[model samples]
Target: MKWTDINNIAIALMDLYPDINPQYVRFTDLYQWVIKLNEFDDEPKRSSEKILEAIQLAWIKDAD
Candidate 1:
């Protein structure tokens, strides 16, 4: 997917899951994950999973 597409998806995800800190997720990472989601043909579910994973990792680091 294009950068703009990935960005839009990320923004939507942020709105849907406010508990996730958008700052901790880099645009490049989101783009890469978007590509993976497309490749796997599970874009929505995988994208949501990736966002949750990123949020979990960020929270873990914050606690450290």
Candidate 2:
């Protein structure tokens, strides 16, 4: 999964952290978690705040 795979990343995050609320997640932690995803594959430096926000939003939606 690359940075563009927002939904996939969100799903992975939901699976990895079912107890945590995506709404309360900080960007710093989100960044680390995204980069560390087993299926994640992309330039870590390619991520931006906009991309992170999209991922977080998607995660929140999936968590609901």
Candidate 3:
């Protein structure tokens, strides 16, 4: 998945870290986890603070 695939990445994050609260997640940790996702394949440099924030927000929604 690419940086824009927020929903898909959110679902994966939910599955990968079911006990963690997305709202409390640090961007650095989030970035590492995202790049490690098996289905994810993209340039790390492509990710930005805004994109990470979107992913975090989506994951928070998914958790709900």
Candidate 4:
């Protein structure tokens, strides 16, 4: 999944970190985690703060 796949990334994150609160996640850690996902396939440099924010927001909503 690429950075544009926000919803898919959020779902994967929720599955991987069910006990973690996305609202409290640091962007740096989030970036690392996303890049580390086996299903994630994209240029790391393609990510931006805006994209990260969208992923976090989606994860937050999914967690609720």
Candidate 5:
């Protein structure tokens, strides 16, 4: 995945979890993770995992 893709994911994440700390998982981290995944030939899987994790985390927080 590219930086633009990760950035778009970050924006959606932020919208879903507005009260969460972006500092803990910023767009930069997502971009870097995508780059790292590219090295392992697991970019798509890793990206989907991260996005799902973000969504789950947001939902958990909302329930609390």
Candidate 6:
């Protein structure tokens, strides 16, 4: 999955970290977790603050 795939990334995160609190996650932490996902194949440099924030927000919704 690429950085632009926010919904899929968020869903993966929700499943990977079921107990995580999205409200408490930092972007740096989120970035690391995302890159480590087995399905995540894009370069880290392709990501930006906007994408990260979008993923975080989506993950928050998924968590809810």
lDDT of each: 0.48, 0.98, 0.95, 0.98, 0.48, 0.95
Better of 3 and 5 by TM-score: 3
Candidate 1 at residue 48, lDDT? 55
- TM-score to true structure, per model: 0.29, 0.98, 0.97, 0.99, 0.34, 0.96
Q: What lDDT score goes with residue 51 in model 2?
A: 99
How much is 55 displaced in model 4, in angstroms?
0.2
TM-score of 5: 0.34
Write the residue-wise lDDT of candidate 3 on 18-37 in tens digits.
99999999999999999999
- Candidate 5 lDDT by residue in tens digits, 1-64: 3423444444555555567665466545544544454223434434554564564455345435
> Pairing residues by index, what is the TM-score of model 2?
0.98
Q: Write the per-residue lDDT of candidate 1 for residues 1-64, one digit (tens) a residue.
A: 4332434445445544467565566646644545554323334434455555554454445434
Please report the candidate that would top lDDT against the real structure: 4
- Candidate 2 has its poorest 10 consecutive residues by lDDT at 33-42
Clashing pairs in 5: none
Model 3: ten consecutive residues of lowest lDDT: 55-64
Which residue segments of model 2 deviate by more than 4 Å? none
Error of 4 at 20 (Å): 0.2
Cα misplacement distance, residue 16 of candidate 2 (Å): 0.4
How many pairs of residues in model 6 come into backbone collision? 0
Q: Alpha carbon lDDT of residue 27, candidate 4?
A: 99
Model 4 local distance difference test score = 0.98
User: How many Å off is the CA of 60 in candidate 6?
Assistant: 0.6
Instruction: Compose the digit string of candidate 4's lDDT tens values, residues 1-64.
Output: 9999999999999999999999999999999999999999999999999999999999999999
